[model samples]
Target: MILSTASSSQANAAFWRFLATRLLVSLLTLLAVSFMIYGLIELMPGDYAERELFRKYSGTGVTITQAEIDRVRADLGLDRPFLVRYGEWLWNVVTRLDFGPAFRVETSVNALIGDKFFYTFVLVVGAMLISYIVAIPVGIWVASRKSGIGDGVVTLLSYLGLALPNFAIALVLLMLNAFVFDLDVTGLVSQEFRDAPWSMAKFLDFLGHAYIPLLVLGWSTTAFQLQTMRGLMKDEMGKLYVTAAQARGFSGWPMLIKYPARHAVMPIVSTIGFDFSRSFNELPIVASILVLGELGQELLLAFLDADQNTAAGILVCITSVIIAANFLSDLLVAALDPRVRMRGGR
Candidate 1:
């Protein structure tokens, strides 16, 4: 009993250390991503002040003089050294949850992003859940019945999903809704509920409109995950351990679930963060096509308008989410696979 207790304590210590290390790595990654995003924005062709002035006076036939642009830059503190501005922005973000201001909109970045991030978060997370929930069972089934008609059908669908761009999917769905269903499927909320205060009716209306984008986003993700799970299961099923288990009178669902299925799930869990990040990377174009007022759409507009602060703020938020997802994936993998914990500890 004493030896068992010591062993348990050592395992606990190792697990905690693993978690701490994973967290430190995630923080460092987030910092590097943020700095790179800010640096890239700084390196862009024109400053926000120049773009804003041109946008404000372009069609009105008013010349935006260099002096006027310089004065506006000074007012917005764009005249400060890049490092100094980044330091202040980073400090505010870390200390007070401030993301600075949106240069073009003349509003706090936090306020501008208020509900957009929430909507995008829901869509991305929902898509991920849909992918995994569908992938795991179907993958196992297809792997067990390889080369069958059902498997062939699924393979065809998965290929099509992977082959088609997300925007193409969105456009096809839009056309289908327009020609056949005649349904209102664009945006996160119906026209009436778009500006309405949050209530049960408004919430339900939002969900009604959200499903189109959700399905559009989830389509390719599900296909990719399904293929991954199918491949892994097939590989695990052919492994020596599985064959050994079969020789020991194990077969059918009981044997498959206990051995190969359990093992196959580890890689799936480990790649959840990558899947999530990929989905977010594809989101901007998809969201724009769907007319969804998510952070993805805002991000594209920010870049086009030379609104660096808004773009930086949105990129930082997305990067942070990706890092957090990766951290969670590590915890989950460690929990499910003792080998991972042992390796990390060592």
Candidate 2:
């Protein structure tokens, strides 16, 4: 009894330590990424002041003078040294949660991003859920039917999904919608609910339009995961433990689920963060094509306008989501597999 209690206590302590270490690493990574994003934006050719001034005077035959540019820079505090500005920005972000202002729109970065990131998060996460839901069963089924026609067909479809670009799929769907369905396929909401208050109708309208982007984003992810799960399941099935389980008369679903499936799923659970990051990497172009009012679109516009504050804010938020997802994945993996916790403890 005493030994059992001691082992349990050790496990609890190890879990807490693992959590703390992951938190520390995530924070440090987020800080470094934020600094790099800010520095890259700073290195861009023109500042917001320059872009605004040039846009204002261009095609009017009025040349923008150095004096005018300098005046605008001074007013916007853009003349400060890079390190000094970055330090202040970092401090403000850390202490006050102030992401500063959107240079072009003259609005707080926080205010400008209101609800936009939420929409993006909902779309990305929804796609991820769909991918996992579809991939797992199909992957298991294909792996079970290895070398059969069903496996060949699924393998072909998975390859096609991975090879075809997401934008191409979106374009094909758009063409089909235009020519055949005549349904509204763009944006997160229909015209009636675009500005409507949050109600069941508006939310249903959102889901109605959301499925296109979800399908587009989830297509490749589902294929990749299906291939991964199938490979992992096949590998696990050939292992000694699976053979031993079969000898014990554990067959079919029970045998697969009890012996191989549990082990095969560990890698998948551990890779949730990477999957989220991959989905986000494809979001900007997809969002633009679909005319979705999400932070991905805002991020592109901010960079084009040289609005560093807005761009940095959006990038940092996206990075935070990825980091948070990674942290959660680590926790889940550690919980499901005691080996992971033991390694962390060591």
Each prediction's Cα lDDT score? Answer: 0.86, 0.87
Per-residue lDDT over 217-246 for candidate 1, one digit per residue giving the tens place of the 0 to 100 score: 999989988898899999998999999999
TM-scores for candidates 1 onward, in order? 0.92, 0.92
Cα distance off (Å), candidate 2, residue 180: 0.6
Look at candidate 1 and give me any clashing residue pairs: none
- Superposed model 2: Cα runs more than 4 Å off: 1-8, 146-149
Model 2 residue 195 CA deviation in Å = 3.4
Please identify model 1 stretches exceeding 4 Å from their true place: 1-8, 59-61, 247-249
Worst 10-residue lDDT window for candidate 2 reads: 337-346
